[model samples]
Target chain A: MTCKEVTRLISESLDRELPFYQRLSLHAHFHLCIFCKRYARQLLFIRETLRSLSQRIEDPVFSLPPLSEEARESMKRRIREQVLPPDQGNLEQ
Target chain B: MNRKQPIDQHQTSHPEVWVDQHGDYLFRYALLRLQNAELAQDLVQDTFLAALRARHSFTGQSSERTWLVGILKHKIIDYLRRSWRECPVDEIDSSLNSIEEFFDKTGHLRDISHGWTADPGTILEQREFQGILERCLAELPFRTATAFSLREMDGLPAEEICKILGISSGNLHVLLYRARTHLRHCLEIHWFVKIRKD
Candidate 1:
């Protein structure tokens, strides 16, 4: 397989299982091809970066603006209305 | 001989505390997926309300955040489905075509001769690297980003992603391929290549 074809296969390999013959040739190409090998490694790295980032503990550094105070108050109010008795005023714990 | 303190089920399940506990996290999850603050906020609000109504079904199997996120995920998919018809499939195709510039007529790579200098572990630790990655992800077509995020970020399977994105399995593969190619290219231009120069 050519470099272009092998690289596409490498990308697809991440998402799905490839046929054995295709996988065999892809590895064979990787043996002789430094460029496609680097390509595959870099793509794998990108995938890892995203996966880990998703699982990482919420860091303020990765900040998207949090819910505003007003929004929070309103959301709490709405939730309280549903859970608390209708006549029960705001209860603080 | 000590007795465990009796905790009120109502107190444990109260949705107001949920607002304080999971609200920001859920908001950020929705914001990343939807990219609209108002809509994200609304979805988080809706998720809490939905959770409250469904409180009795809380099996305690998953963490509270996970359960809430599951609810938000459905909401996000519903929003995407509503907008799916307007998604420009041709635009996504043109973007993939741009990636072909990396290859020659003989199907050989043009200029990616050297490996990246920074190690993946080190790069993953850098906050700035993530910032650049988020920017690259934002550059992708909406549906392409949705497929990539569901698969890569959320660790969802392609079959599941296809269902959520309302695409076929083959189309999901194409979207994933496009996502990886575009993100790699974008990072090369914006981050990796720049690091090489410096």
Candidate 2:
């Protein structure tokens, strides 16, 4: 495959696994082609950053503002009712 | 004393414990995607209620946090999916312009010769780095950001994201590609490049 084809495949590979021979050729191309190597590294950088950021963002105590005291009480009350809350409140754009 | 309950009777503990133990985490998780305090809190409420209803399915295979996060993820997706359908599909974002510029007439990268002086991906672990990442994510177009979050952060299947975003498989690929490339450029310029230069 040409460099252009391999680069596009790199994005597709993120969604699903690449084909076996295609994976082999892409890996082979990485060694022989500087642009493909750089392209692959950039994608990896994005994935790694996202994964780590996702992990930290979800930490039980990662330091984003906690739910307010009143919000907590309101939440507990709603949960205790054991019914889905009304959809009066919509997500802000 | 771990007594296994039937799937229908899978009650583990009172629901209030969930508020104390998980309310904050779930709120932040939702806020990261929704970026709205009210919606985030509301989604956490919905997740807790849903957990109560499906308590029987709490098989104890995962940590409570993990279980709660799973429920929260679904609530966010369902919420976003509904909202996405209500709103018109956004105009194509300018974020793709730089990506187009990266390639030449033929699809080869215009200039991809150099690599990072060091792999800056690890810097994302820092709290400040995470803040920067969130800002970058917030800058993306609504559907672009949602498509990215559903796929990358929530780890939803591409097919699932396609359904939620009301996009085709081909469109989903391009959307995800646009999101990642845009974010990469953002983080590169805002954090990586700034830090490396300094």
For DockQ, the strongest prediction is 1
- Could you tell me the TM-score of chain B in model 2? 0.77
* Candidate 2 global TM-score: 0.76
Q: Each predicted complex: what DockQ?
A: 0.50, 0.32
lDDT of 2 by residue, B1-198 (tens): 124323333446667788998888888888877878998988888888888777767888897789999889878878888887876655456434546766687777665445655444456446677688778887787777788888777778898778767789888887777777677666667776667667
Report the poorest 10 consecutive residues by lDDT, candidate 1 chain A: A84-93
Q: Per-residue alpha-carbon lDDT of model 2 for A1-93, expressed as tens digits?
A: 776678777878889887899899899988888878777788777776666656776554355778999989987887766532321122211
Provide i-RMS per model in Å: 5.2, 7.8
True contacts kept of each: 0.69, 0.60
Q: Report how far off residue B72 is in candidate 1 (Å).
A: 1.6
- Pairs with backbone N, CA or C atoms under 3 Å apart (clashes), candidate 2: B10-B56
What TM-score, computed on C-alpha atoms, does each candidate reach?
0.85, 0.76
| lDDT by candidate, in order shown | 0.78, 0.74
DockQ of 2: 0.32
